[model samples]
Target: MMFENTLAFARKLDAEDPLKNYREQFYIPQQNGKEVIYFCGNSLGLQPKSVRKLVEEELEKWQNLAVEGHFTGDNPWFTYHKQFKEPVARLVGALPHEVIVMNNLTTNLHLMLVSFYQPSGKRIKIITEKGAFPSDQYALESQVRYHGHNPDEVIIELAPREGECTLRTEDIISTIEQHSQELALVMMGGLNYYTGQVFDMQAITDAGHKAGAYVGFDLAHAAGNIMLDLHAWQVDFAVWCTYKYLNSSPGGVAGAFIHEKHAANTQLPRFAGWWGHREEERFQMKKGFIPIYGADGWQLANAPILLMAAHKAALAIFDEVGMEAVSRKSKKLTGYLEYMLKSNPVMEKRIQIITPENPAERGSQLSLLVKEGGKQLFEAISAAGVIADWREPNAIRVAPAPLYNSFEEVFRFHEILSGHLR
Candidate 1:
């Protein structure tokens, strides 16, 4: 891919892109009444233009069918969620029954924890990474208390070794091995939200099983950003939100995966609701919670149709452009971003690229460790019309999504950011 100038790299890539046309499907944001270089898709993704039609279809069905909308809508309110099964399953590499569209990410995480994190006396500890998203940390804390266990005592948070930006695979496996008897669950993020370091799920799963512990992940950053095979990896369960790399909008619907091995066992205790009951027996006003098989049984309420429609729109593009293709482009796009950042004098020495250098170990997002004028730098970048995220003290997250973000936008970010350097 030859380019005449730095800004032309994006044009060349776009010309060769198979899924380039899908970029037009979204509603891009404007800063000065012109489209800004949008590199924040890892935080809140751009919206799909087809969302209105999808929502309107539901609206029409609601007004016409009224009470009958449950079974009569274009997609049908009753099984609107089911229409998404195949696409969602394909995204995470799972069987249809192993996945379900429902609730928000944090809510689904709590629900999954209820069924999967069953701790007993002595074997009551949970193993997770330090500085996980606050919601996951909170849920795990409350869950531990709910089980009459102390989170501080029961939750073992693994930290990176001195001077290391990310956790080592060996350290995680060793932690599981050392705590095998005491550790009941290895619940952690599939990718660190701050570092953009993707965990070795297969290795983690193998180690957890060896320790007689169940392994699961919060795939909020990993879901659409990386390729995963939950079943093949031997992961017991996983949860993810659609709003990030999935491009489904903020607080969008979430989904989960429960391995087939656990699907048939009725022994797993769940915090269930009427919606989780079998379809045939649900209308009987069932007495006992006759749970639906697999991941569907994790649901705790009626499906949110509007939210699911947004997810459906996002999944359509994902299905059209397979993860293999998406991930391949992602590596080059992100590698270019890293290359540009490193080329800068101060940013290279002062700011750290916390994300793994290996393309296979990361996604679209790069977490930059800004220094000195960190807050000022983040605010300056945003004012310059480059949409990036600032996390707490000194990190800025910039993701150039393959579907919509351009390499030219990345050059503009460099131009904007370089001007602010000392």
Candidate 2:
């Protein structure tokens, strides 16, 4: 498809977009009196208009039913988390029993590590990408320390080749192969937060298993942004936050996936709570922690109803439209953003796109490596009604969310950006 730089052309594309109407579902932020072009979905998505209504229903149930709300309400609090099984599983291409909406991403990551990261004699090392999200890095460091191992010795950080912005799949697979004898676990962000590079999860999972190690992904950026098949890929486990592409409210309740193979293993070590006990036996309040059948067994507490309400409201949109359609528009929208950025000769000299050029290897985000005054440029765009993200040192990250962002807004962004290139 030929992409033209003209606003008229952008409007034509938006006019033709099948998902354009869905934009009305969300409340876009405003600057002064005008709506801003939001490109920060990678950081936090805009609120869905339906959120308030859903949340109010839950509040009404609590007020009307009191303690009986657990069993009496429309969406009973007793089994609230169960409703998401089908939709969340469908969203990430996993079996319903393999997925659970529960605690936040890092907490779930710790639970996954407890079960999967069983380091043993001679196999005490864990492999992960260099510059992982700080939460992951901290979690790995603390976990290693808990097990009486030095983080420097137990954790192997794989880096991109010098001058390259992202890791090559070959390099990642070879790194797993190189330390096969000592590798206990392989964990990484499914889509890198900074570079916006989507890793080959299937390849990485296969390589990790071949090396006799467990594989997991921190899907904080991947879950709703890209098409994932954790079950098909045989990833041991995965976790993701909902506030970004899933568009739940701020710090929304998160989700986790455990392949049926692992989820069914009741004997697997996990930090369990009463909510994870078998439903039939839960009220009995017995001594032994007899786990539930699958991913539900990993839950540490009862659902946070309000947060889950927001999540449910947000996921309904995905359930209606489907991930395949969402992914298609994401590729086209992000591609247009890249094309618009690269079309200018001045930008060629001033900015470098650090994200993978191949649509298959990236999500909606494109990280621009500004040659100079990157933060100042980011502030300029922000001041002109563009809500983008800036990471330390240089890059300005922009994500044209397919769910709400329009092609015309992307063009407007390019126009605003071009004005400040000097």
Candidate 3:
């Protein structure tokens, strides 16, 4: 764990890492044709080389077979949608039947709310963190409004205690208990985007159920970055985008999970299209809708082969590096980054990490609360070829994806920050 120099330390970590080989699998960025330090996987992930080959096969199938490609070609488009289920299901720790690749994140959230959030008059409240992702907030609001209810009356936002950057578990549990009688759905992000706090999902799910509510999550920041046991936790439902940690390309197809218990409950209403219909009954043009049980019941259209192909490429890598191994390396990589950042503060006062110090409480992302010329300092970091993101007034986000990021990269980024801060 010791470095002859910072670079040597990083190279050593890379040498000992079982997952280090994956760095070559991605299309890393360059400045003057040299690889740049990439710490932004929490935003847009680097592309996998296999993505092109996967997409090209589909393109070739389209060019040659045309409509016949649905049942022809290497991976026929006929059952193309089903191809994504197994890998994605394993990635999030769910049964194959319990997961499906489908629409974008917000859209899937809205669709899930339709069947799961059956809020009856008085017991129609929704619970979430106060400053959640904008898409999640918007979906929750639209769902409330769609139910002929005012969001102000039915939405309960849990906030951190004064001066605390992260939500206390006690606060979340108490908020759910306080609203038990009126609570209907507990929809939240698995990890906070700004604070980098990983919520205790198992505890939260248990509490929500005790409150007589359906518990679900937006794992946009959690999937691939953290270990999840949604089925074991009894999470009623969940949705996530693959573009972030999954490295599936931007605007990639999203995936969802529905507990096995909800699979056969046909009484639950869903917004169905041909894809959700029973495959045998689908072409039959049946008079009444019959859903494919479990996660398959949520689909509304055919899969986008191009996007799913890209996703399959990424998932293949994840399949190679198990979640436990990825998460194990993640803590060390990010922990090292944090240590280096704190080390630079004496050299410069403008840098302060808002992310929680506890390793179990955060993924790879670290949000920095700058003390001076915040945006200017961030721009300087960018100019120095460190590609992290600056959000809002004064915070910058850097995530060292275990798949490609290295200890040396962390050291190099700090070298740039120290230059400006000093």
Off by over 4 Å in 2: none
True-structure lDDT of candidate 3: 0.88
- In model 1, the Cα lDDT at residue 181 comes to 84
After the best TM-score superposition of candidate 2, give how far the Cα of residue 252 lies from its true spot, in angstroms: 0.7
Residues 280-376, candidate 3: write the lDDT tens digits.
8788887888899989988899888899889989999999888999999999898888877765546446666878888888998999888778899
Instruction: Return the lDDT, model 1, position 98.
Output: 94
Please give me the total number of clashing residue pairs in predicted model 2.
0
Clashing pairs in 1: none
What are the runs in model 3 whose C-alpha is more than 4 Å off? 1-5
Give the best candidate by lDDT. 2
**Native-referenced Cα lDDT, model 1:** 0.86
Question: What is the number of backbone collisions in each predicted candidate, taken in the order shown?
Answer: 0, 0, 1
> If scored against the real structure, what TM-score would every candidate get?
0.97, 0.99, 0.97
lDDT comparing candidate 2 with the true structure: 0.93
